[model samples]
Target: MNRTPPSARTGNRRIRWPVVAGLSVVTAVITAVLGHQVPKSPSTSPTSAVPPQAPRGQHRDVPGEADGVVPDGVTVFDDAIPAVANLDPGLLKALRQAAKAAVNDGIEFGVNGGWRSAAYQNQLLRQAVATYGSEEEAARWVATAETSRHVSGDAVDIGRSDATAWLSEHGAGYGLCRIYRNEPWHYELRTDAIDHGCPRMYADPTQDPRMQQ
Candidate 1:
């Protein structure tokens, strides 16, 4: 048509499409420049997964070196204390030798308890709770982590309760020591005094006050 519509004739002119296109190009260029200036993630390098070897002249801690021996067995408890007769091979040898020495001295140092699994410890805790009403109450009568030497397979309870005193005096000479002060029945071979290919069995020896004796 030669004449414009009434709506278009009276209204102000609209922005041209070319201007909008130009503005879009400008916005895209600005965004690209800003993005280029942004930081990038650090690059990763290939690494070997193998463990490093220990340095030369370094010796690992082993049991029984204080008395010039190695552990002959380790304890693992499957059931009640009396039922625990078996021991770790290394621990068994040491026990046999110590027991022989004790027998010659007219003392009986029988194995009262040995190795124990987490399940066994849990059962013991449950039984204690049942009898004492609460874990805290049971702990007072029983040994807790600070007093537990059972976590290490080397610890054991020997003979009747009275034997604890004798063991305390003579056990270390045989490469054994009462580790926890609170647990009179707990004992472990002197691991720090020995040379093994591993670090000391105990991270903190002082945690067990009996070790000092």
Candidate 2:
């Protein structure tokens, strides 16, 4: 006689469905919790918002409007070496006014070294270094771009050394002021302008890389 095997006969046996149902419910709860905790997208915050547009008429057709504007009396020195400087348009207007005022007061005012190339500045720096030795030593005698006011094009080396004292007394009326601590010669049209001196490197403004050097 052949005996019936229990394993072979267990094909239709029930799988405890309650245990499987409980596991499914637990998995659903875990998924819901994780979904709530984690952000769906990586870039969703107020701080990551896009920038706003610039106001109308604020942008000018100038090279360094981001830097500053050229004052009224000041003009670009378009020589073989280009000198593009920005002044306070108001200050420049004031310079003309001041020049008129100075004329009334018998003081002669003139502007020199408004905007300079980094090469010209470097040449001056080299001369200073040659005379003094070491940049630190030269800085005591001459201004670096970081300390030079000429980079902004707002600052100018006035005609006379005593111009600072005269400007200090009268510049605010024209929106101009001396920006440097040591360089009595340097003056800027804007009162709020930063006082960093001449840039270390000056690029030729006329050269266009697209035109083939």
Candidate 3:
């Protein structure tokens, strides 16, 4: 048997230990790199996974109440002659009740107009003056901005001849009355009309005391 030299054996041992240490160090480095990368990759996923929330006060289903416009023939706002949102609260409530009653009776009450913005009222006055050829003549058709009940949100223009006719007979019970004989479409809240019945219709808006202002 040949005897091994101690120096040679020691040299071999030293070479093996270094290789093992090097491999261990490489493994630790790979693990550290992977650990650092793993944290960053998951960070983005959590943020992206969060669901979006709806905006506050956004009514996705109803457009009329949300926008306050209630285009012609769309009557989602409380069955008002149009949308009742801008009308006086009391007046709107009365109109809703009256409209509901009308609906039950097989008449679909509608509003062609209700509650005018000051700008809109002014625009109507201007248009009326242009058509009628004078401010005096316009007053008979459209009230001054300051005196218009439509601007005050206490008035509405009922739509459809049948709706108007139904109201002529039954509206007094709801405290609604036609103010102008010439414009049967125009109606106003007169709670007194509920008890005493609507005051006799004026021959026209010009004859209305409220419009005299």
Candidate 4:
């Protein structure tokens, strides 16, 4: 009655260690491979806030230092840079005169932004869109390529609080007037402003009629 069953024999039981270990390795390898994603190429899509109103290729991606990136310590008098040299002739003359006068007050007129190529202006609009979350909000800061005055060499953005402060006080004398109430750094030439004083400020680029273009 006490006979041991044949199924209870030690050698009769199948060992699953090898099969379980192999399956675990295969599962791990598959998981590792699936977890990673291949990277995609960068895109050059136009801004949704204000689409490219300019003709195609009008603002091609031009490569060079003159692509609207102002160097540190760059000033209104830095003609070596295309950004400074390519400004509207009358605007440049007015800026140089203003810079000369500002020096007497120990305020060097630094050029933060000026004479942007259309490509560069579009780059700025995209960057603004990224930072502000919405293209509409970005439009309030940066104008579209077709409407931007910087592309036309008609606008200059001054740097440093002190420089802008001095310009705010005396900029009208040289026909350099701040155009945007929100952007104290932005100024444009208004030749008549020399005698009649600067005109009323728009709240932002969005408020300017030209930006609607």
The worst-scoring run of ten residues by lDDT in candidate 3 lies at 60-69
The TM-score, computed over Cα atoms with residue i paired to residue i, of candidate 1 is: 0.44
User: lDDT by residue for model 1 over 60-114, one digit each (tens)?
Assistant: 3332222112233322322223224334445556556676776666766655456
Candidates' TM-scores? 0.44, 0.45, 0.63, 0.70
Q: Per-residue alpha-carbon lDDT of model 3 for 113-180, expressed as tens digits?
A: 77766666777788899999999888888887799887788888887888888889998998989988
TM-score, ranked from best to worst = 4, 3, 2, 1
Q: What is the lDDT of residue 191 in candidate 3?
A: 95
Error of 1 at 152 (Å): 5.4
Question: Candidates 1 and 4: which is better by TM-score?
Answer: 4
Clashing residue pairs, candidate 3? 81-110, 81-111
* Per-residue lDDT of candidate 2, residues 1-213 (tens digit): 996688755642444566778899999999999999997776657788877998888964333323322334433232222333244355456566666666666665655556654445555677888987786666654455544545544556665645556766776666665644555656556543324322221222112131122
lDDT of 1 at 93: 60
As a whole number from 0 to 100, the lDDT of residue 122 in candidate 4 is: 86
Best by TM-score: 4
Q: Using lDDT as the measure, which candidate wins?
A: 4
Scored by CA lDDT, what does every candidate get? 0.54, 0.54, 0.78, 0.89
